[model samples]
Target: MAELKEARVPDIGDDKDVPVIELLVQPGDTVKKDQGLVTLESDKATMEVPAPFDGIVRELKVKIGDELSEGSVVALIEPAAAAPAGDAKPVAPPPQPSPASGGGSEVAAKAAIPATPAPATAAPTAAVVETPTRSPPVAFDADALMPGKVPHASPAVRLFARELGVDLAQLSGSARAGRITKEDVQAFVKAALAGGGAPRASGGGGGLDLIPWPKVDFAKFGAIESKPLSRIQKLSGANLARNWAMIPHVTQHDDADITEMEAFRKKGEENKDTKVTPLVFLIKAVVAALKKYPNFNASLDGDNLVLKQYFHIGIAVDTPDGLVVPVIRDADRKGLLELAKELGEISAKARDKKLSSADMQGGCFSISSLGGIGGTGFTPIINAPEVAILGVSRSAMKPVWNGKEFAPRLVLPMSLSYDHRVIDGAAAARFTAYLAQVLGDLRRLLL
Candidate 1:
């Protein structure tokens, strides 16, 4: 007699009442041991609960959006007594939040580490690519895969891709008959990161299968003329979209007291040959902070972090055509006066549309200053191949508690946006504090 087994949620650490984003099987489906039964998403990560033993799913107790806790019954299954010997071996508990690579927490646009092996489903579908060269191979009936047909995927794979924000249509399926599988999506992300490109986003573009953009005449409401996007707009638009979609960005806002630094800049007004600006001072301060936090001067190359020893800072310049970032190479080596002079020259070249592509390359970090234009604060998108960017807003006078009394201080609003994959909240907060501290005390530059 076949024994009935209940597939239950395993011990997913501290993530109580996690939401189920996907259901991998339906009632009456014959499932194999260790097959993923559902995908649960907590605040930190997306996890899949797998079957405990080989069995037939007699009933499913949960649905999408249902909250689940550890040891919760997932589905009732009638265990197969004559199952293969391979199925009898005790299944290793799924990998935990690893100290080495928090593979458990990293999912979606920025996670570089390989996600825990999303268990395979018993359904006849696309073959899943195995990870670590040691996980069990995806096994089931061969007819589950049909060549020269539509790409095949289990329900689990679809949910996995959705969590990662990957457009399944854009990927070249790695399984037979061009089927898209969980492993395929993971591999696609790895390839995209290695190429310094992001997996195309779904909806309004590729994945998600969204509705086509409406092609209605606006003239019906009022007279209007269609203008083609400028060359720079067309180019920058695509890059901006890609960056926004792929990177998990978090912005940390702070205020830097540049009261002393401003006084120093005005003194240079007498020298017509070299006019110093607050931006020059900012560039220097930023370089000093980058030296303290080397990770800020690094890019995620595949699974590896590429840390550059040299500093090449990019300053965002608003030009007539569009926004352009001109690189200030060897910013660390340049003094405040030299940086100010170089800044003036490069900015002029940018506005004149004379900057070569090389002039914009090799930036380890970027600064987008809107001080002159005016803004309290803004989140700046990260320039990829670089992990972070600093947004500088207009400085204004604010009252500060001087321990003895309140004093009017010139405060510059600063926003630091970083890729959450490479930087955590605590580190970002510390970086912002350090930057503000340096800007507040110009003497720190001497160190």
Candidate 2:
């Protein structure tokens, strides 16, 4: 015999009249014990009300924006048959990829030089991939009547919506149970800017007064097919767009003579356990430079600059899903061999989609190496919070005058992109010059 029960909100401290922000389950959905039924948001934080027992949801008593107290009923549930033992183990969700603050590239652990950072290039297609995925419209209902209701969304999505000057109440979510996602907010902005939907609020954080993106019918001229961006691409695109628009970027280009450094690396490769790549050296060099120029290790915090005393370098790794940056904490303390080993481990984790949020945070500086893929020079974007990013290009042999005679020396191109507001032209020049000088001599890295 099945048992019928009511799932009610548990004691949520002294908070009262909390608004329902998300519905985690739909009617007829089977849920496990302690599974979230509905999400409630107060001023401080958001929390989920759980099911008292394993059961199937019968009905939802509340909707998005509905106010509920501690004793408020969330749903009617019917206890179901015990789940199979095989279902006891929980499966982990795939890791979502985040954007690096530079031209995106894969980090190769053992390559002679760092892999180059480049924009994601699309393969040749018959037509463009520009279709917008939208949810089915809701007919006249409670949502229609409550135009100013609070939206059912995550904190990150809410922040993104606010940045785009979007009123979430006016938008319909395309996610499960009508919950909103980053992609949903992006689609809404696209439609509004293309003159297909309501105009967004003016003077919002990201509300730039610009002409609408031109709508084109590519099929009218030739064969066409619609391809949507992957979840990683969509999310990364949003952040990149925001960073590009908000930051005043300037690129300082220079070349380092790495003839002796390369020879040393090659010599060290004879010992398999102590092998090192140019990137490991670059990490140490960057840390040394940051110690020399403390401003490079700081972030712009409104009116104040917050300088970080520790060294954690972000290395961008390309995965099948997208580019993700995993940070190497305390880079200043790690030796070349240790950094190389950790880089290998981090790169493997990134590709396997096993990187956690902590693996990507607390980076004071970032290095995007594009040495594997040949390029003379390119500008890398500054990842926000951090004010500067270093870009490494392929190294080439060039003739140099060594006082009396010309000699062929290996030269590596380096590009440093910084927030102009924080870094001046002369400072950037000196930083690059100092970095180049350090790279030119292997002994400088020891100091």
lDDT of 2 at 437: 91
Residue-wise C-alpha lDDT for candidate 2, range 124-212, written one tens digit per residue: 11011132112245342323212223566666677577667677766678876577899988887777645585654443433554455
User: Could you tell me how far off, in angstroms, the CA of residue 1 lies in candidate 1 after the best superposition?
Assistant: 28
- Using all chains and alpha carbons, the TM-scores for the candidates as numbered come to 0.67, 0.55
Clashes of each: 2, 6
- Put down candidate 1 lDDT per residue, 243-288, tens digits, no spaces: 8877889999999888888887787688888888888888889898
